[model samples]
Target: MIKTLDSVSNHEHRQIIEKTGYKVETLRIWKTGILKHSISNPSNEQLETFAMNVDAVLEKSNLHIDSKNEIRANCTSHFLNERRRTSKQGKETKENIKVVNNIKKKIRDNNLTVVKADKGSCMVILDRNLYINKVEEFMNENGFVKLDNNPTSRLINKVKNFRVSKEFEDKFGKYKNLIPSNPKIPKLYGLPKLHMDNIPIRPIVSLINTPVYKISKFLSDKLKDLTEFKPTYSIKNSGQLAESLKNLQIRRVLN
Candidate 1:
């Protein structure tokens, strides 16, 4: 397996793997069905120490819940600092996760879902069925209807046929390079607005791989060049906005 990994062409391969390494021994001992522990790349001495520590905890410490929790040794618990920690640990632990246990029953009883925060690496707990109903309500309010069947394949064929048609080719031949070779069906999804009181789901249409992607991109680029003349109103960032505000003037209207 090491030899096979070394022979893998895409990598700047290691010439020879280290002998008596913990990782190598782990792979050598690995089974087909069983997954290996991610962080427990323990050497012989570390393994022995870990076993002794576990024995110490079980013998010296009470098997009671609070005592068991109190007996959490760094050596006994693998990757004490890293195993269950996430990048958003500070934010989550401080604001969200601390109260999660208290609300667990309330969530389960209400049949709510615990989904991810939209803009940040946090959690947003909301009822998924209720969320779906609200989304459906919004869609209905905006005159959007549910389709009876998926029209993705049919839509693709239609677009492809139109692209190859004589009239279409004649009209759009100059922009052939801008046309996408392969197009994907567009998807619509919603992100939870956690900051809002009602926690509305903000609708977003993902268009990167869709049929209109290339044409829309081209049009946007063209429009940008045309609209760049209005520099005062077309503020993009905070810096530009600030600069625009600084130069603002309200002229008195001549009656």
Candidate 2:
């Protein structure tokens, strides 16, 4: 059998060698075509060890092969593109953090309270009484005329009377009946409601009625120095800011 195997060409011997199980000695014998004097069938223990080694080699090879296949399927440029995308995201996150920190610092420097609301919007609240006092001081300094008291009730009465008057009837025409006889006026709890030169001045705590795009644009303008920062305000943030400001007022009232 050894002589016949030796007589065969190398290609024939290789073909025979490929068909055998993963026994190292068997392959060597078939490949070399040399029969060692002590040649014998592998022991069961030897076979098991050889099989385990072969499986280990195959598993390692398969891992490398799968990686190569993935690279080929996605194109060779995939790794580079993935790295660049991750780097860009990291840089953007860092820039956003820096901008937010800067805004917080600015607020602190101005001795104002800034609270982050939902959807990336923030609220700036000032002491209402202090702010009103400042406005009064400024008006007094400028020799501006001021009303004796708040005109909230007076304005409500005026609006109510106008709704039932001939002017409202002439303007609204058929819609006159649709107007409520006793319309409820929105109550201003902690807001400053003063009159200057007979013009009613009311402080707004909520910007909920303002457009999100406008708010974003406003924030962008305010924080323009932070070139990498882009503002994006949602309507939800506006409502949250209003609610927070109201809570602040309620806290003050309770205190």
Top lDDT model: 1
RMSD of 1: 22.4
TM-score of 1: 0.41
Tell me the RMSD of model 2 versus the true structure.
35.5
Candidate 2: tens digits of C-alpha lDDT, residues 125-208: 333344456446555675767579866567545533553457745853543243344434333222222212321223333433
lDDT of each: 0.55, 0.42
- Model 2: residue 104 alpha-carbon error in angstroms: 2.2
After the best TM-score superposition of candidate 2, give how far the Cα of residue 242 lies from its true spot, in angstroms.
Answer: 42
lDDT of 1 at 8: 23
TM-score of each: 0.41, 0.23
Off by over 4 Å in 2: 1-87, 109-138, 164-255
Model 2 weakest 10-residue run by lDDT: 115-124
